[model samples]
Target: MTETDIPALLALRDNPPFEKMHTVAISGMGPVGMVAALRLAQLGHDVIVFEALGGLSAEARASTFHPSSLELLEQLGVVEELHAVGLKAPIYQYRERSGAVLSQMDMTLLEGETAYPYRLQSEQNNLTEIILGKLQDMPNVTLRFNSPVARVERGDRHVRIHLEGGHRDEPILAQWMIACDGAASPTRKSLGIAFEGTTYDDRFLVISTTHEFREDLGEDLAYVSYIYDPTEWGVLLRTPNHWRALFPVTDAETDEEVMSAENMEARMQRLNPKDTPYEIVHRNVYAVNMRSASTYASGQVLLAGDAAHCNNPLGGMGMNSGIHDAWAAVECINAVLTEGVDATHAATLYSELRRDAAINHVQARAQKNYDNMRQDDDAARAEQADQLSAMDRDLFEKREHQRNSAMFTSLRLTLGRLKRELHAVKAPAVSGGQKFSKLLGQGPVYAAGAYDAVSAKLVEQAGFKAVYVPGSAVSASVMGQPDLGYIGLAEMAEAVRRITAATDLPVIVDGDTGYGGVLQAAEAVRRLEQVGAAGIQFEDQLAPKRCGHLAGKALVETEEMVAKVKIAVAERTSAVIIARTDAKGVEGFEGALARAAAYAEAGADLVFAEGVYSLEELTALRDAVRTVVGGRPLMVNLSEAGDSSALPPLELAHEAGVGFLIHPVSAVLAAAEGIAATYQRLLTTGASGKGQEDWKQFTTLLRQDEQLERASRLAAGEA
Candidate 1:
């Protein structure tokens, strides 16, 4: 493509011709809805955006745009315009009320990770103006101000949106509808999806002033600073023309007492001891909530922005995450309507991923920021200070901390982690089986054990080939119970379901004692397969089976155990069935070999010789099992505490002919030990024992540098 034709060519490539065009109605013309409408129009869809208000309101709301949000705006071709009018804040600080910097987070650390690595301080109204201006220019987009959506009615083919008091009485009909209304979304309420979560008892007072506090203090300060004080913890943020202060108001304080002109002047004066009374231009009070819709989409009606979820504004993630929701909704909508993808499946995945990010990242981090600032207990405050100091001292930890605090990594991380899940859900059903078999042949695979979705994601990022869901680890971590077969088939299957959904890595679950007899073993296989297990290891132990290394373990008859193995193998379609025998502790090494041979004969794809006492024994067991089932894989359980003949290096296991080396409890064990030590240090010394600079570098490695660069190039029209 020549330079002259490049723009047209790139536009054509980016905007693919849709097989079928769609009319999408979006309610609530806030930033979220407007962005969604613009994106849909770009994707060759007819978009109509409705607004309850007569026009955009110049309200004091979220004013900081993190790197991720900027990247999203850049994708919509408005970041440059925003940056021209917005102030760039490269650093933000956590400070004491007395103007002492406790810790400073430099957004520049995200330099290589995102296109726009600094926080942009601008009024929310500016963004609205830019988006509204763009929307007005799009021929395919319809902007309807003062057109409130009364109710959303879903039909078999399309969605009908009823307007409350519009000039036209006819209801709007569209193939898809997105709700971008605020938190008290009428559409969400009409759909009956619970907006469930906590609402803080304290109301926040936000005040704007033109007076320059930094000039009076005579010290360079971050554009945004969270001040910690037991008496009056609050947040200070700078906008283009004004500085804003947000303070918490307790039940003891009345609105009149907190919002009075004298109170506002006093609070601002306390920060800098101004020569004259501080000028407060405007002030507003509002309660913060951590609420989310049960689902983002129901039928053809989808929810975005505050309509789907809302959270405390401490981390400035509410609007950012809502924008993310808008993009995700449009992508899924386009995929379903134009790309021949399943609508229900795409919508469900959107709901699952966005809701998860909102709750786990946005809400959780906002709560942490709030708690860190308002901690009253002396020891707790000291510990929090130490943690922040550590983040400041270590660039890696600081970058990771800043990523979450700025909401720069929320969307990227969420979607990146869910890529495999999206593929699994959208791909042909037989792909899972094929993928599992292919992964098996690629052994000797090292599988990390995980009990939760977060751990599973970390394992996937750590470059593990698969996840091993150990019964012992799951029982201990999830239920705080011992691994004595207390966790049944249903519980284990559910755990596998979550881990598998969170990642694309093949997961092998420990089906202890098959949860019962042979019939139960068949049922267990079916349940695990249905929930997306790539493989399951069935151990040869009686009901209530204990850990292999633990005492009081009993095994069923060899024939009976062989029967269960056969049942598992027969019931599973694409799931690998590995038969594990705990016979070493009871029937001696020779007897264990015999049981392994029988299980192999019963069509087990892999044989696990549990509790081998030495490297020699493991080698011997692998050789013997190979003799019984030529060329078939053998699994080795490398437990730190279990009777693994020797904890040989992974290379040695491969040399010894072991196909799968499973560290059954290593991940959770290390996490538990680390957390315990950290907590113990905090309890004793009121600080983390490790030096401030000595922190794990995992989060740094999780940064999306390449993805951000790609987005930057795309936004700049650099094909």
Candidate 2:
């Protein structure tokens, strides 16, 4: 593909409808680059992507797509093609080098959770090629192959990038430049930013063996199978019809010295040492490194994919994380150019968000994996295994002890007594006819479907103070949640101030995880008070809180949560503080009640026990908290088909002497079921569209009217 082959641009003058003021030059036509370009094009931005190679990069780097990443591709219109060309791995297996059965983790465990519950095997080269094909069909996207940017200069409002292989010596000027230029980014280097991290000195020989192990390993052996041993460590993984073995190289030897086909077979013999016939067909050396950019964006120039961060492929995080970075970059860039918001602020947030996510989650997990794989000493391994066994045994012992211990029961009664004592403490009396109202939905609405119209219309017409979460086809599909933010105290206060700008309704701002530690919650409360929110509720769940509906969720320590409540209470000037406990399943009502009573003493205005199962539990809770909290509100998660007891929300609210009831997820829950159904239909039909004929019309309602109007004007100017 050449610049002249950009079919849409060649016909632009004839079309007369194709023109734009701000052109975003996306460097690199790799998967990350292509996805970003595609999203920008769909948003009616003029996108010119530069690729160094004549076509797609030929490196067979990433050979599989994670389910989460695949969902993003499904939104981008390439998931079907991926499934067609790629092998779906539904089962994961682990085995000892001596063919001993260890443990196998089946992806079937994730069957109902995600639409695509398995990984797909397809080379990154092919994936890039496919994305390039999609970009070619877009009228707003220009794919400039064999043209790499030699230099990038960022001015106050525009960016200038000089291409090496182009006909002209003149540089291309655009509003933004994204460097998806792979692991070694010259664009990033040109900005004088240092990538901070350590590169692993130890290398591994990655051999692609033609020998099929499926017959012996079983057809279901499509997984990340690790062969554990101190020395001669290896990992056997599937790639379509072939198998790849990763053999670790010792410290004294170099790749050339230890990775020949003969030596490869020898190492495999040492690790496997089995009767199964597996031979090396191809051998290559890989030096895994852990590195992240100090910054993701420098002025108008930004980084994505491997350019931003790279990690060892221990849990297949390296490539998947890059894909996530691509989605984030697209959202941030769109917010800047289209929304006319603070692009700099958005970029800073993006950098920190992606960088922290990769470092704390991916890099940390990779390091832990290395420890798990390279465990050498026999005594040490034995001790570790024994410790694991002991922990499992201890779980049973603890449960039995809890059942028998009089101390445990006495502790519960003492907490109950504390609750009664706190209840006796008089709450400020409600003045005659004095009204207090809590504004809900200060954040984005997540549910879609027919309910989307209901939720959107409700916010639009309710006269209730609220804000709309922007809806983008790419963002809405990939992030699996609406984008919402308050940034800092000032920004949050600004949001609250604006809600009252239109109406007098009190706002209930979603203070996600309290923004910081318990010590900081008070400061957050002070900030929220300035913003004009009447109340703020902080959850017991940890940061980057999983969607409240997901299972196997973990809650934070009870004491730490109580401390946060205390901080929130100490900090609040006017805004009411609500403490939400997610200890329903992770811990039972006893733990939940204990935490709630503690929070009331800490000065919480309301106590919320989420995920409660029955009226019996809800009644018990209301009776328990009434003693300590007094007339302060009690809130319960009102679920239609949820575990919040068989009691209706209003009746329960009245019975429990609860002052408030929050439907934190009513609209979202309804939206999820509908969006999920629509996704299923799209997957089955293999049709590319906005779903129903009226979907295009319906989506306009889903967006913030003013933002969409602004976007339409921008798109029109581009056309």
Candidate 3:
């Protein structure tokens, strides 16, 4: 293919034409695996589910299902069955040991956000069993009980599993393998992926009893209550037939001591003192860990639920997010089998989206909740309680309800995190680079600067051809620090990842001094490649890097900059590498143009001269670099208007045949100004209200309508 044919070629290769279903193997019969099996089967894929155990356990596990989970389950047509055997807790409370209510969030406030807003006080077994029942009825599904998956052999295009049960002589082969097995998954172990995280010092001690906690605690107490004490923080949960209380067993205690009848009775008595000993029906202890696999997808095998991640149960995020992963796994596979998406692209997209969910959402929130409940400083803890108490009912209900409900989902977690735009993890048909290349075909188009997923959404909503994620913006918005190189490679890449997930627009990210030297720049190239960065521009500025537009900038030697450019081009997978020089401000304009040409000659896909003093210099650099790029467009960094009077306007740049313009600080400036005004309005008026119509408009940016359409189609038995 010719150089100019790259766009049409990538565009064509991205959307290959074919559709074929294949057999899928699901390991483990937990809620995650069951949901995967059911969804895949419902979508008409041949599915075989292997369970290590003979049958489902009635143990008390993951009793509180969130509203977001309910909405997702509703899509699968299982919410009604789940509700049939579950109790709805519309209100949950955070309480002091003295029974004083610190804060209570009424789920009713989120009724409009979700169809079923309350936490369903039902064990995870209910959902698994319900799905299993449906799976058995479906002709596309086959269940294998008493069958433990020993390991999986990955093939080029499929997976083969060796079972430990009597099926050792019979290796089962399938096109896809989803390991929803527990944290100690054989599939994950076999794949050799690291499950990196920490095992908490405290072992969880759970006691299930016939005692009615709501009646004893008080009528005002909700069915779900987290009571805090410096000595011991306890969680009181109501199951369908019993009340379960969970406490932390320190290293000083053993499982035998924690689960002993006397200790269990005393713990229950402390929760609700009674004349007679509390009726402890069952008692168990298990270690809790906060961990997620390095990657959720590998070749044909995909890890879901506990196999991919584990977390503290305080927020009930484990099972809910796992269910979300299960759906993602199925959706991605379906995309490959039916939607004509490339198989590897579909799998990688699932890994990127779900691993993000596991790390940033599930594990992070669980750890935060654990820390919140076990705050050691009395004054600080009391201050937090006071803040919760003083928070407006509407505000508290809105925030806490979503937080507790796991509404801050990873797929669309931006609003959930930034209170801005949420990341939607839907699979895009084209790679970011492919999209970017096609747009570059239009000639001299600019990218709107996005500091976060929120701004990326705004840029897409406003119809920008591409997104420019600046390291300066990350330093300013995230760290609240000036762009003097406070952030590193990982931080900037994460910003790009979140922004890329928010929209289909191509994102060109800034690599400040390559975060170090040549080796570091190579790693930056690889990291940016993994995160779907459409383009990456590496500058020649020294450490403690200043923004390109700022004064007192310095540039490395021309050979050094060229070496960085050479390494980046050699290391990148699909991202376009634009070599940038800060020489115009540090050296001379001619020297800057010389460095840009040198880097371009050294194999840079594009070239840029930062701190260009005038439109004349931009045009000169553009002409110099085009000789090496085979007619590829030139790039310019356009900061805020206040930053420089020498910068050229858009019309003039386009007129000059410039292509790739970057408004690197526009969104940050707008966001800062809007935030200042909002805070001032709240201070002056004692109220800051956002109109429902405004929220509606914002939700559209998250693709809520597309999400609803998919859910509607799924519920209506259409794939």
Candidate 4:
């Protein structure tokens, strides 16, 4: 077949030996970790859960569930079952110590707008048990107590986990590791991620009693009532046949003084009055702290649940936020396992999204809730409580504002900004010869306002192929050839497979002198052919080659390169083997030309006379190739420094007899120029806000007639 008529290359497919997960280890078995493991096992992946605690324990933590989180649980197919067991509290009452109800929130008003309008008041441990039941049913899931990962090791292909189980002193190896451990996690400590934040000075001495004051309350037993008086302020949450009450206690308060059953009964008597009859069931104490890890991912180790971020339970966001992290991690892991996007970057994105969400939305709101509770000065605290009460009332009853008060309004606005920030795409950096192609495709076009998708469309619109190198492009790197011998033999094979799948271009892959000496070069060439690469190029530079523009650049001996070229040509099955000479600028034009001629005589399919500085040099090299090999193809580097200013593509094809031109630095120039222009504009304005109106216009551009007209014209192919 003719060269232009060569068959269309199909995408390269990988059949990884570790195709299915057999033993998956999760470091934490908290609510998020437990739920995630259950979901993974439900999807048929063998799952192992490790918890520091020997068994599950009851805790009155994170009791309020948001409507969004409930919806998520429903999606996981567990919320309906959980809802059946938990009390759906539909209203919150704010009252003064004097027994006057200041304001009340009616969550039932949220009906029709959400599937679950009322917040569920089940203890977090109960929710954990619910998830545990679903997890236990999965045949592939194993729950191990008193077992934790000691360390983690990762390779290009798989991650090895070091496990310290309760029964065994020795460590066990697992295929993959997930650190879902809680806040103050050993796994996070091992990963070297910094947890940053402060613990509140206040703590809660929680008392559970079979309190029958529901009738004196004159409210639904499910209602969560907050006492607004500074000295007597606390929460009254109802559970089955028992009332779990939390009263704020200063850190200075002794545990003996706070935990005394007599003191607790007196506190309850002072708040509920009429000497309310009750039966104390259980009691505990907990401190509230809010912190965020500096990073969520370090190589193969990942942070999930409380290990990543901890929030105050005032707003009941702690466990709920952890659940969100679990969901986000699942999506990220799926992307890495299915798509070729780098695993590290994917993990980083997961951390960024989850951490930001918790810090900005959950933690901040929880702090506001704390402020409403712990403000000093009785009169000022009362005023703040009254405001919170009024806001809650307005939020529940005021339908015109969507029943949204200042709190919910700020929440919506914050969440809106978060969504916009999360959706913003960042353009990447490019350098070296790769910059040529980037500039040609994106620099000018993106300056004219085209990004990756638009730039690709522009290429398709201009009827040209748009190829991308996974990493930044280096000079003399092979285009179509597979195998990176400099890194490793196994890595070389994978790189070859990736390039095959990446593009259908006659891949001009740089073999860096065929992955070593002549024998290695021959074997690498054979592997490249087996992987379906169209061609391989061997550079004239000596081993451990540095960039051409750098100092102390060295060249391989001309005869040695010729020998490698001969070996490469003999080993290839259906691939072209091009020999490159990086000798033009290093040694004068004569040395480069002579090397090209020798390579051609040595049966090289194509010869590259790199660093040709002038049209005169290119002309001489072209003529020399004609003398030796007649009309064999010749590759040229159309660099800016090459002094080929007016040598357009058609002109080069017609006048120079050059078969290919590698304009690698074009995109890099365009990107750097655009970024610099933006920086300069920002400096001129003394701020980065002027173009915001334009950005808003672009974001909401459909409302503008001019934009709509342009869009319509573009849609109609009139642009």
Residues 1-719 of candidate 4 have per-residue lDDT tens digits of: 11121111101001111212234568877788877787667656667687777877565566666665676688778887777778877776666667666666676676777777677867677778888888877777778777766665553223445565423222333344567878878778866779999987887778887766677766553357776555667777776446777788888888888888778888778767765455777877778778999988766566877888887666556777777677666655554554434556666666667767777777887777667765668788767766665665565344322223212333344345434543343323221122222222111111111112322233234333332211113221324222222343345455556554533333445566565778888888877666645556778777676544444668888888989988987887646567888787688778888988889889876676665445555666766763211132466554443444434333333234444445434444465577678788788977654477767754542336677889999999997
Candidate 2 per-residue lDDT, tens place, 521-589, comes to 677777766655566778787754544555767777877888888888777665667787777767787
Using TM-score as the measure, the top candidate is: 1
Question: lDDT score of model 2?
Answer: 0.61
lDDT of 1 by residue, 323-419 (tens): 8889888888887767556667777888888988888888888888888888899999899889888877888788778777767567876667446
lDDT of each: 0.79, 0.61, 0.78, 0.60
Q: How close is candidate 3 to the true structure, as a TM-score?
A: 0.55
lDDT of 3 by residue, 375-469 (tens): 88989897877767776455855566465455544645521332121122333566777566545543454677998988998998886678898
Number of colliding residue pairs in each model: 3, 13, 4, 26
Candidate 2: where is the Cα deviation over 4 Å?
1-22, 165-169, 218-220, 273-279, 383-719
lDDT of 1: 0.79
**Cα RMSD to native, each candidate?**
26.8, 27.5, 23.5, 20.1
- Local lDDT at 183 for model 4: 83
Better of 2 and 4 by lDDT: 2
Model 4, clash count? 26
Residue-level error in angstroms, candidate 4, position 216: 2.8
Which residue ranges in model 3 land beyond 4 Å of their true spot?
1-22, 165-169, 392-397, 400-404, 414-719
**Candidate 4: Cα lDDT at 62:** 62
